[model samples]
Target chain A: MAVTKPITRFTLFGGVVVLLLCLSVFPSSGQAPKNKDLVHVEAYASHKRVNSGKSFHIIITANIKQGFHINSHKPLDEFLLPTVLRFNETKGIAFGSVCYPKPKQVLFPFSPNHLSVYDGKISIFAEGKVSRNISSGDINVSGIFTYQACNDQMCFMPESVGFDIPLKIVKAD
Target chain B: MVAVGGFLIGIILFAQVANHVHKIFDPLQIKNLVSVKQLFSAKIPEGVPVKLPDLIITTIEGEQLVLKELTSRNRLVVVNFWASWCSPCVEEMPHFEKINRDYQNKNVTFLGIATKDLLSVVRKFIVQKEITYKIAMDDQDKIANAFGGVKVLPTTIFIDNNNRIVKIHKGYLSQRELDENLKDLLH
Candidate 1:
């Protein structure tokens, strides 16, 4: 009986080791889906302080989710909503035409035609001028970034992200 | 060892307890779990049987539809997932309508499902575009998500009289592709 005891223990340990190996091979079915956000927008002015009546640059960057893309400012498809950026009328700042970044033309598996789209991250630049009549003080300028994000298969609803940029006004340099 | 056996038993007991809790408290989640299971098991088959749950759809024409019921009645169902904002979807809709008309006497039902679209906007757009097929809004996007997440607009799924989904085409279907696919699947 004593001699058989070691063999019994060895057999039990072998069974446990085999079970552990099988369990490790067939792991859990992956994490549950979280309705993750698709896009984030950030904006900043070129200079910390710009003199009144002088021109400064406003740079805006859109970070799109990995699998999604947005139509360019000038998309080839007429029906697609093009990304548009515009600043609201403000007392301190006035804007000029925006310079949109170049877009990648991709022929998706689901598209018959190649689409001009912006993916990953893209930066947009615009020239803003401080009003000559405005006093030297901190000013807030609001703007909107509008886009429709889509993956290869479906497009999300068109949405807009608003940005408020603060500028420090000073005498002309 | 006893410890290993206990661990295995614990996992089994925990799963059983969670299943019972869901059955008692949240029946809707239990229903969704079935769909999720079916989704993984199903592949858009060119030959094999594609099994799906009987999901309810309320069309714009105010008629309720059950996909399994329609297929069981010796009718083929063509479901197109589309949106008003999808340009390719809009472009190919007229072609879909023409094919729909061609199969008037045939045992085929064409349902245009507008996904991620406002009901009012879709109604107005369809009227302006002269779409005559049965239209419905997938407001919650549950229908599209079931058919392998319809990652593209203008995806088409064909269910046969046996209630098996035979084909799922993702992308714009030209008139020729639409006609050929319908003909091939019909016979």
Candidate 2:
């Protein structure tokens, strides 16, 4: 019984060391899964370099997975979830209305009415203006693109894929 | 050496506790904390009975039939409106088949209406999916519009023996949900 107390303390110290070793060996293994592969997004700026206070277009091209289509930003049905783009507030940047390409009218076999949907590739354009006071350098304007994709037979869970648009703010001529 | 043995036992006990905690607090299970009905935003009719719509559709087999003709057989009719491109609609087909098989002898009918789909695609999909229930194609979208304008995929309508619509279930229905919805029809 006398030796049991020292043994407990010794075991505790050893357990702590083993736990630390395990953590060091497998860093980032316990993190929550990331959003990948469901949908691919590519951001583009109309002009790589724009004068301060001048407006430019940021185009986001979303390529849906093969055999799948996402509902248009303005879905014909009220119940259907529409694709939406939300921009995060950033300093020295002013964003305008986002314009989405018109959806192709698809009349599925199950319904007589045509649905508003986008398949393969769809582009969303956003107008942005750099602040006059901003310095001449590259800056990123990030945002989220959310959509629900469905193939010929089933609807997948909705996903929000993040996107970043890089633009260079040059001094006015 | 005895002290080391005691430490090993303590480690095992701690491991067991951690596992139990993980099971109890699994976030994946908690992600769907909202009610099942919240999955869709559609305004579905519940319990309030309505008469079956008078609409005819052509089956993929090229046979023309009215939906009520099947309902008039004095059995509970489950009309599911689905499309080949609708993912949720495809996912629930197997469950519908299983339930259809179980109620083979019972006075029940499962009718799947393929709307806005091509006949070639529907024929190909049925063979690939091995669908066993009755499938009809509404190429003209007449049947869909008759059923209160089926705007959503996987909209299931339940009609009683009296040819009255007992309920309209919108969205995907799990096995348990199917069973729950057919309680009046089966039992």
Candidate 3:
């Protein structure tokens, strides 16, 4: 394993998850403790290859790490940051509206109202249609998932995870 | 008959929404549960104190506070980054308020900085919690990024008399820890 200065890089699925640890702040004698990840996201297309003019759903799944939760796309509270996903349109690909799963509400000691959040595995689906003009090849549909993850007591900074769903286009027979 | 059916469906939907909000009405069940609290915090080792830049921060009440003026004349400054949405930050706020009250006119100033939070929410929170210490907003996380990007909530930075950041504590710090850190800085 190649060791990099300061930053310890880990490859999650196909993306590089760069976690800036607080180890550098501690003394040399202090042992570094393992911190938990707030959330993990991965995405894939319903059909790896699709016929021209055919439609498919792009599935994006976010797994909230144990002991953490992220606000839903439509958080019930006005003060909360809503989780959002944006697909960067590529050539010959038409994107449709993305669907977000309903969030679970949990009552904690902090707030008087129940907080709408996503825990465990939650998937967001987006519809995409392939254009008839594209030739048979691989095309990358890039998107970014933005969320603010929080545990029972504290919340981490808002983060955006970028992903790509590659699809192969075949001419309609 | 149609009205009755619509009312029944509405009741069912309301029940489903209520079920999602897990509220334990039975206080007797609390004994069976174990409270688990986890935090990743560490002590900052002695290093070269970074020269912290002075900036202007506007409070929710439309007042401005300058970092350079607060740190002038060898005064110690405590800047705590917190948000109303963060429960741990709310829990740790009282300790800072206590310390802020204790350090009045003692060459120590405690300023609570809010980032990624709503002004109205913060205002309601302060009033509800009776927070009297000077508080301000760090727009676009400018102050947080300046202090090396506070990734976690309730991150506290201590600046000594020399206008340099001396220590940084991450995560929930208890009142005892706050007292200990202050004792070290004072003497």
Name the candidate that leads on DockQ: 1
Residue-level lDDT tens digits of model 3 in B74-155:
4678999998766568778988989888878777888899978878778898898899988888769888877766777878
TM-score, candidate 3, chain B alone? 0.72
lDDT per model vs. reference: 0.76, 0.73, 0.74
lDDT per residue (tens digit) for residues B56-112 in model 2: 767667677666776778478898988776656866888899989988887788889
Worst 10 residues of 1 chain A by lDDT: A27-36
Q: Which sections of candidate 2 miss by over 4 Å?
A: A1-58, A61-173, B1-49
Candidate 3 — which pairs collide?
none
* Docking band of candidate 1: acceptable
Complex DockQ per candidate: 0.29, 0.07, 0.15
Q: How does candidate 3 score on lDDT? A: 0.74
Q: Quote each prediction's TM-score.
A: 0.60, 0.45, 0.61
- Please provide, for model 1 over A91-162, each residue's C-alpha lDDT reduced to its tens digit, 9 standing for 90 to 100: 878899999999999887555688899999899999999888889888887899998877765566677889
Report the C-alpha lDDT of model 1 over B1-187, residue by residue, as the tens digit. 9989978876875565554344333432232233555433223422223566777888988899887787787467999998887766877899989988888898788899998788888888889889999999988878876665655677788877666566667667778878977776665
Best by lDDT: 1
User: For model 2, what is the alpha-carbon lDDT of residue B169?
Assistant: 70
Docking class of 3: incorrect
The most accurate candidate by TM-score is 3
Query: Which ten contiguous residues of candidate 3 chain B have the minimum total lDDT?
Result: B31-40
**For candidate 2, lDDT tens digit of each residue in A1-173?**
99899899788768766765563465332121222454688888899888998999889999877766788998876456689989999788999999999888886643456779999878999999888988898888899988877655445546788878778889886
